[model samples]
Target: MTAKLPAPITLTGRHVRLEPLGRAHVPDLFAAGGGDEEVWRWIPTPVPRTVEEMAAVVDARLADTACEPFAVVDRASGRAIGVTCYFDASAEDELLEIGGTWYARAVWRTAVNTEAKLLLLTHAFEDLGMGRVVWKTDHLNERSQNAIQRLGASYEGTFRRSRRRPDGSWRDSVYFSMLREEWPVAKARLTERLHAGAAVPA
Candidate 1:
């Protein structure tokens, strides 16, 4: 099968469902994270001070051909609690980056993030036949780095002066990746953790 950008689809797991992001998710998305400094701290964009600003963020992602954005809905609550994306898609290279991820404070230490990664990684490597899935975060964001490492991604390296942060300071990005040949082992570990009730550490 040829690797390609995933078409808009719903990915369901025991803990959450990732749906194609849309305007309908805006209210819940805003309520979930808008203006929460801590939630947006490590993110590239500044904290959106209003729902409209958050909506613009979502809209920009939607307009970008390179990104497939999803609204992460908690199955138990039936609410959009977060956002994620499969971005920087390269069909020929058989790879994509799983970035632009953030969830509400309420779901921060829950199974939501773990299961969401499971669903996304499964779809990328299993369904789309991608050879690699990449993840990156600010070098100082230890919490995010730990979460990515917990998912079994190997630390590729750090990219110095990668990009300017919202506050106008330069950010050094820490990169990690998992390969297709390594999927079975990584998948098994992630699945076991999810089944064992492992959550993203606070």
Candidate 2:
């Protein structure tokens, strides 16, 4: 199985538009979610303390060939309130992991995450023709786990001590995935949930 790596593209939804992550978004992103430890808790990198640090982080993400990042812009505010990405892609395997996601507290209990994910998944399977889309979160992040499950991904199991966190703690990676065959049902459920203004725990 083979697939092309996702190219930079904008995925628009009712609540948000996922623009290709760029330097221009750092200011808005910083204003939106920067300096929030809670938002960066499960993230592997150091919590950015300033806009400059945020720019450095964004640059690092953009420099990585394996990462295709997006700035999650609020449709109403037109500000980048968060970031998400297709990470560690394997074109030869028709697989990629969706990781490195973070959002502002303002959008936490809203439909923003649900709609943003719908856009990404639609493009992953329908446009990129990917066979699988994966998500892995720290075992300690129950909210993230719940969010992934709510997206109709099946829990694959845990990988113990998969990596060390920025704080040097061993991270047990909890894995979930949605296969192409199962996408129709998941997509239907997600679309319905989106209409209901569902609050995702991601």
Per-model TM-score versus the true fold: 0.95, 0.95
The stretch of ten residues in a row with the least summed lDDT in candidate 2 is 1-10
On residues 1-202, what C-alpha lDDT tens digit does candidate 2 reach at each position?
3332557899988889999999999999899878999999999999999999999999999888878999999999989999999976676677888889999987897898888889999998998778999999999999999999999999999999998999988999999999999999999998988787666666
Clashing pairs in 1: none
Question: Which stretches in model 1 have alpha-carbon errors above 4 Å?
Answer: 1-6
Worst 10 residues of 1 by lDDT: 1-10
Error of 2 at 199 (Å): 2.6
lDDT of 2 at 148: 95
Residue 128 displacement (Å), model 2: 0.6
The sequence of per-residue lDDT tens digits that candidate 1 reaches over residues 1-202 is: 3332657999999989999999889989999999999999999987888999989989888888878999999999899999999998787888899999999999988889989999999999988878999999999999999999988899999999999998899999999999999999989988888889987553
